[model samples]
Target: MNGIEHYRRAEELMEQATATRTNKSGFEVCYVTNEEQERLTRLANVHALLALSAAQADATEFKRELYRANGEELPAAQSAKERAEAKTARNAALAAAFID
Candidate 1:
């Protein structure tokens, strides 16, 4: 699936996790258990990350293509090790942002 598809799936999961229903008495109620909700939220986050990664890759590819079309020498790409470290740091920051 593409980035937009993954993003849409993530949004759908998030909605399911937090959705409220009107009970017969006309009060809003959540049917999902805490554990289930947490699981759904985690899944949503995974999809969101996948979408973000795909988007970044697409952007990089587009930039490379544009440079090529302009007869410009492409900039050196990051080494695999550098990319891994950057991804690790980015993930750490994202995790930290979710901490209480």
Candidate 2:
């Protein structure tokens, strides 16, 4: 599956983890156990990471294509420091997005 597909799967898993369902008597109940919910959430996080990685790779390829099309030299690989900084920023943004 592609990045978007992984992302959609992750969303579905999260929804399943959090959604309430009606019991036999028609009262709303959380069907999932705490452990089950935690497991699902962890799986969803894995998928989200995969999606993010795929998106970054696609963006890099797109930039390379654009440079080639414009007859410009491709950009150099990111230095280790730059990569570390980017990772930190990405993690921070993700944490902010998930903040309650």
Candidate 3:
């Protein structure tokens, strides 16, 4: 597969890992080896790139919405990484059914 395709796949992996991190363990990330953490970080980066490329981002409030959707500020070091993981998760859930 090409680079963008790889990015899409990485985004999927990040989404899955985020779900497991949030739902099953109720932790952002914990108890993973260094290799696993590195992989997860890479996945988050790919998802952020995909999200930005696909996004219209038409409003000023979109920035705040991203944070709210993410559910927290996330750790300082992990902030960007976390936001990207959440970009397409919760807010998209809201946007899909939002009434105009």
Candidate 4:
């Protein structure tokens, strides 16, 4: 799935985690268990990072395209696509590390 999809899934999980129900004494009780909360937190974080990475990559590409359109020289370092990909990969790796 795409980054946006991941984000949507994370949002759904967050909603699930925060869901509540009325208790016998009219007190609110969280619907999710502690383990479910932890898992949802981890997954939400990972998906959020992925979404951010995707946005960064999109912005980089847009900037590069603008530069090319303006007849400006590309950067001497890595290409926009390469840099974006590297950044996204690093973010994903970090998320994976957290899960592990």
Highest TM-score scorer: 1
- Summarize candidate 2's per-residue lDDT along 5-90 as a digit string, tens digits: 99999999999899898989999998899999999999999999999999999999999999999999997799999999999999
Residue 62 in candidate 4, Cα distance off native in Å = 0.8
The residue pairs in collision within model 2 are none
Candidate 1: which pairs clash? none
lDDT digits (tens) for residues 23-95 of candidate 3:
4757565456667767887877876666565453434357667777989663345577787878868887888
TM-score of 1: 0.71
User: Candidates' lDDT values, in order?
Assistant: 0.96, 0.95, 0.64, 0.88
What's the TM-score of every candidate structure? 0.71, 0.69, 0.29, 0.67
- Clashing residue pairs in candidate 4 are none
State how far residue 92 of model 1 sits from its true place (Å).
37
lDDT of 4 by residue, 5-49 (tens): 878988987888788999999999997999999998888888888
| Candidate 2 Cα RMSD (Å) | 12.6
Task: Name the best candidate (by lDDT).
Answer: 1
Which residues of candidate 4, in runs, are more than 4 Å off?
A: 77-100
Model 1, 1-100: lDDT tens digits are 9999999999999999999999999999998889989999999999999999999999999999999999998877899999999999999999999994
Q: TM-score-based ranking, best first?
A: 1, 2, 4, 3
In model 2, state the lDDT of residue 68.
93
Model 3 alpha-carbon drift over 4 Å, by segment = 1-29, 56-100
